[model samples]
Target: MVETKLLMIDDEESFLATMEKRLSFRDIVVNSSSSGPEGLKILDENPDMDVVLLDVKMPEMDGIEVLRRIKAAHPLVEVIMLT
Candidate 1:
């Protein structure tokens, strides 16, 4: 089976770092962003990522708003919300 690519977005840098390390161990191409803008950029750059793990609370742009844009921009990808 092919390893799926993933993106995890959160405002807390420490949390994103930890999750990145953990997910990478499973041979998945895991990328995490510490802000909504950065996450959007990642989504634009890697249009083929399989799933996105998103947090509901954020500063500049809330996860819900980010998720909305992400879905609008890339409807094919899967999204999992974490609060």
Candidate 2:
């Protein structure tokens, strides 16, 4: 059995790193980006990604905007915004 692949977007590097490590230990494939645009890029680049854990606050594009874009591009993928 394989764990789900989760893409996490957060401006806080520490949180992302820690979550990635913990999930990785549980056999999840986790990729991370620090901003919305980069997460969009991740969606474009990794279309098969199973889910996204996005932070609500960010520098450039922000979480809602990123979510809008993500939904527009890949509506079937799951997204959970962490505020």
**Per-residue lDDT for 1-83 in model 1, tens only?**
69999999999888988888888779799889988899999999999999999999999999999999999999999999989
Best by TM-score: 2
Q: Residue 38 in candidate 2 has what lDDT?
A: 87
**For every model shown, what is its TM-score relative to the native structure?**
0.93, 0.95
lDDT (10s digit) by residue, model 2, range 35-67:
899889988999999999999989888899999
